[model samples]
Target: MNKKKPITPFGWAIKQRLTELQMDQKSFCELHGIPPSRLSNLIHGTRKAARYRQLVAKLLDIHLTEEK
Candidate 1:
């Protein structure tokens, strides 16, 4: 079964922007020097590595506000 993987809100935003730019995760990670695993953690809210998360936001030109 090819089930759709559920994405977190942050991941959704990143995915939307990536889709608009026609960019893929591996390419984006390589371009920005972010390790793929870290990116996964950030998008999933698994790890709060502030520096790397900030870098991703900056590179994507996105502003991430507090969830609540």
Candidate 2:
């Protein structure tokens, strides 16, 4: 049906960690040398690039948990 999907555990983790650090996604992307668009895609689970996923997780030091 092409319904919008929920944010993944990894995505939520990234956002949560960013919020904890009091940083915005744009700033986090810029600071980490990641394109904002790519980060968005990564969070939305559209970007399936393993390398980028690993880089983001490592850089953010995030542990993923699905919130309900």
Candidate 3:
């Protein structure tokens, strides 16, 4: 039997775009209204949630970018 581990799709996606934009955690948090500490945790993979990351994605316009 095989069990698959859960994935943090939103967090992973955000991290990717941030890297692409050459953005640091502080700047990204400031731009997105995310608490610095919380953003740090999320980016470091210490946190996981669909709703929060979805909001982050939307706020950062990642969803729109993905559509293009």
Candidate 4:
């Protein structure tokens, strides 16, 4: 039997925040200046670039750890 891995804490937090804000992918992408396809891929499990993550945290006004 294979076990499925959980999403990373950061990724999970981002997903939750997006849901809480009631923002859709297209709107989120536009707000963050990220390509729609790229944001979609990230939500689907692609690791977002570090810079993109930082920008996201700032734009969404979510506090991220220093390690982020």
**Top-lDDT structure, candidate number:** 1
Task: Write down the TM-score of every candidate.
Answer: 0.83, 0.79, 0.51, 0.61
Itemize residue pairs with steric clashes in candidate 2.
none
Give lDDT tens digits, candidate 3, residues 1-68: 74533334555777788788899768977886778866655555566544555677676677623220
Number of clashing residue pairs, candidate 4: 0
The weakest ten consecutive residues by lDDT in model 3 span 59-68
Candidate 4 local lDDT, residue 44: 48
What is the alpha-carbon lDDT for the whole of candidate 3? 0.63
RMSD of 2: 3.8
- The TM-score of candidate 3 is 0.51
Per lDDT, what order, best first? Answer: 1, 2, 4, 3
| Per-residue error (Å), model 2, residue 19 | 0.5
> What overall lDDT goes with each candidate model?
0.82, 0.80, 0.63, 0.68
lDDT of 3 at 34: 75
lDDT of 2 by residue, 1-68 (tens): 87656787788888998999999999988898888878887788876756677788888896544333
Instruction: Report the C-alpha lDDT of model 1 over 7-67, residue by residue, as the tens digit.
Output: 5687888888888889999899999889998888777777777898788888888888876
Clashing pairs in 4: none
Instruction: Let me know the TM-score candidate 4 reaches against the reference structure.
Output: 0.61
